[model samples]
Every structure is written in structure tokens, then in C-alpha cells.
Target: MWHISEYDIDKAVIKLRHENADFRRRLKHEMLLPTDIENIICMASFGIIHLELQPQIIKCKKQ
Candidate 1:
């Protein structure tokens, strides 16, 4: 499991809506599914320049 914020989800949804209002209106109001967000994250990650992704698992440590 990963820690994701409601604010982050809302921000993403708002961005999506701006990009395509009709598609956004068709979606129901509900919490974002993790898989949906994961897909979005994967797509966005590719947008980063010079970022490397390693295929390995790392446990999160709370500060």
C-alpha cells in the first residue's frame, strides 16, 4: 500500500477535467481507485527528464 493524499487526487482530477471536460463529467463522484492513479503516475513518470526507474521494491519508512 502507498500513502496518497485526497488533495493530490483532487488536483489530478481537476487537471484531467481541464484537459477534457466532457470525459470528466461522465465520471461519477467517488474516491480515485488506486489502479487509476497508478496508471496516471506511470504516464507522468515518463514525462520527467533524466529520471531513472529501478525495478526493485523499497519499503517506506515514516519520518
Candidate 2:
């Protein structure tokens, strides 16, 4: 079974920050944004990464 604890989330973000160039670029843009756009991009990144890690969870709901 796939689990997504806080540790797993932190690890995934760290891994993506280092290994995924597109994610890293989006993260940079996300940080620079001063509005809800940052939240939108950040959520999108998490959604994409979550799907990559656990494709079986179609809705990507937290458990």
C-alpha cells in the first residue's frame, strides 16, 4: 500500500526539487509570486507529484 505521511511529503518535495527540473522551475516561480497564483502552482505541483508516486489514487485524496 502507498502511504503519504508528512515525512514522505517532505522527502518527495526534496527529491523533486533536486531531480525534477520542471518542478524546480515551477517552485521558483511559485515562491516569487505574491498572490494566490503561488498557491495554485504549488497545489498543481503536489498533485502531479502525488500522481507520479501513487497513480492508483485517482483523486489523490489524503488518508
Each candidate: what lDDT?
0.47, 0.46
Candidate 2 per-residue C-alpha lDDT over 1-63 given as tens digits, one digit per residue, 9 for 90 to 100:
534466655665667678867666756555322322333334445554322222221222234
Q: Give per-residue CA lDDT, model 1, range 1-63, as digits (tens).
A: 444456655665666667755435434444334444553454444433232445443332445
Alpha-carbon RMSD of each model: 9.9, 11.2
> What are the runs in model 2 whose C-alpha is more than 4 Å off?
1-3, 31-63
Off by over 4 Å in 1: 28-63
**Pairs of residues clashing in candidate 2:** none
C-alpha RMSD between model 1 and the true structure: 9.9
Error of 2 at 44 (Å): 15
Q: Which ten residues in a row have the lowest lDDT in candidate 1?
A: 43-52
